[model samples]
Target: MRRKLTLKDVSRESGLSTFTVSRALAGAEGVSKESREAVLRVAEEMGYVPNLAAQKLRGVASSTIAVITAGTSNAYYLDMMNGIQAVAQDMDQTVVLTDIAIGGVYDIGRERQTIQRLLEGRVGGVISTLTLLPESVKRLEDWEIPIVFVDSSPPEELPYVPSVTTDNYNASLLVGAHLQSHAFQDWLLLVYPPIWSSRKERERGLRDAAAKAGATIEVVEAGNNAASASKALRDCLGRRGGRLPDILIAGNNPILLGAFQVARERNTIIPDNMAMVCFDDFPFAPYLDPPVTVLNERSEEIGRLSAHMLTEIMSAQIEARKAGKPAAPIYTNEHQLQVPVDLVVRRSCGCPDPTRSRS
Candidate 1:
């Protein structure tokens, strides 16, 4: 039997994205006139028809959970995702992942579109890696879909919203203390933007730590990618009379990679020329030419905890609905969690360990 025409077929034939095709077929907004016309032309030529029954059935998606994140360029993203998937799989729930940013560039419009798509699909729960807009949170709440944030906090206006994340302020203090131990007087922090809420905490802690240590610290903002980090660092160096700081602090794995790229380009030896450390630990940290020191955020643990919290709330909502009661999710003090982090020391921060170290 021949396969029936679907969104994928329309997308392939129209040379447009599946998202664009979906909006075009539904006569929804966000589809340009040119794209909509092309999609309609292709659907007519292919004898396409909407599968209303299938869509109606798909709308009963109480067993599906969506995980939303900014981007997934670093290895730690996999670790956290594995933990989330483990819990979801054990609960017999399907998982869907959506990235609001590609190539480490955050887009508010993309985030808005993603939330709408999830709602339209009748997702039962959401796990976000970063804070979302207030209205987006409200829509999910109004629908009674449980949401749990991982590696980031909910917006300030919704303090009761559940989250699982490291104590970033303390984590930065930990990093700062270690840098002080090495007596590094000048530190350069090349960090990503504040869209990832943790940036604010991390920066605050670093600022306080620098003051306490009597060390000079400078921050250069960059997009959340290695290429952006490289450019930012290169420009920062140019601004500083081409003099390297005593130590460089990268906010995350991608930024760390960019810092390395700049150092190598300048023939700058690790620790000898400048010490370095980063926020998240990755697989290659131990195996790098000079093993990198990093703050261990325990991403897998965060992911598992986040998924468990969302599932708990969702289970409660289901029970409430079954009992013909209000089906809003439950939130308690336990739901607002702050997991502590540890700094893993290595040669990259001027430690004299020539061998691979444990994290």
Candidate 2:
């Protein structure tokens, strides 16, 4: 059997320190051009190949992008993850998915712990699906770990952080208008809490629309999962003495399912008995009994854009560090973008097949 060469052998032949040889072999910064060339030449002559698995076992930092998500059961995340994974695969980067939700609910203690874990792991970058606490955001920034928020934003105090999301306010307005077109006077919005941050803009738009149309809108808060949403809807209906709202606006996919479950338990028909609409478009949205009206927020596109933006920042940071420059990720106005949404009209909103949308 032939002896497998090592960095030590390259170091012995090149007359460079083992540390320099290792850095040169990894193509990392801090090695001079001439030293790197000599190290490469010696390494080629010695037939030394870097072992990635061994490097990982030795606690070396990895270029793994972390995607922090809440409400993992929501179908919206599946398509979003697909988009992020596609970008990561193309970039030859690995992705780690971390859910801060415990028992299908977002927990502050878990958020704090997750942040510390990622920092300790020395991850290459992060893509968060919710607005993290101010302290968590601060800690990540202080560590120079590039982060991109997808479907969310930075803390209000850190307005310059990069984010890619839908224009939720406008999307809400679009939803409200379609509902108003059906002459719905009483509205009910079943939504998750502000931990997601998107709830704020979405509620604001709906509120404004309700006021403009002189319609009464009731907002119901629920956990970010289907079970909680189902209970919230049941409770709200109980308080209303079983009086269903003119139209029900679901916050997301999970909430939508919860609403459907409640409707089923009561033997209620959609549109005729009570109309329905939701924030996100899922695979089964159009295939349901009556189909569903939805605000197509383009989740996959948002995910892809967020990952691309993070990778670009990471690349820039690497180049800067290589040139002995400040390596913090550079963010600009362009880094914070909101993709427009389209209203996909289906029969659930009382629209006929001819009135159905193509979005």
Local distance difference test values of all predictions, in order: 0.88, 0.87
List the candidate 1 regions with Cα displacement exceeding 4 Å: 1-25, 28-56, 354-359
Instruction: Write model 2 residue lDDT over 90-153, tens digit each, in one string.
Output: 9988899999985469889999888877865778899999899988887677667889999998
Q: Candidate 1 at 258: error in angstroms?
A: 0.7
User: For model 2, what is the error of residue 256's alpha carbon versus the real structure, in angstroms, after optimal superposition?
Assistant: 0.8
| Each prediction's TM-score versus the true structure | 0.85, 0.82
Runs off by more than 4 Å, candidate 2: 1-62, 355-359
Residue pairs clashing, model 1: none
How far off is residue 188 in model 2, in Å?
0.5
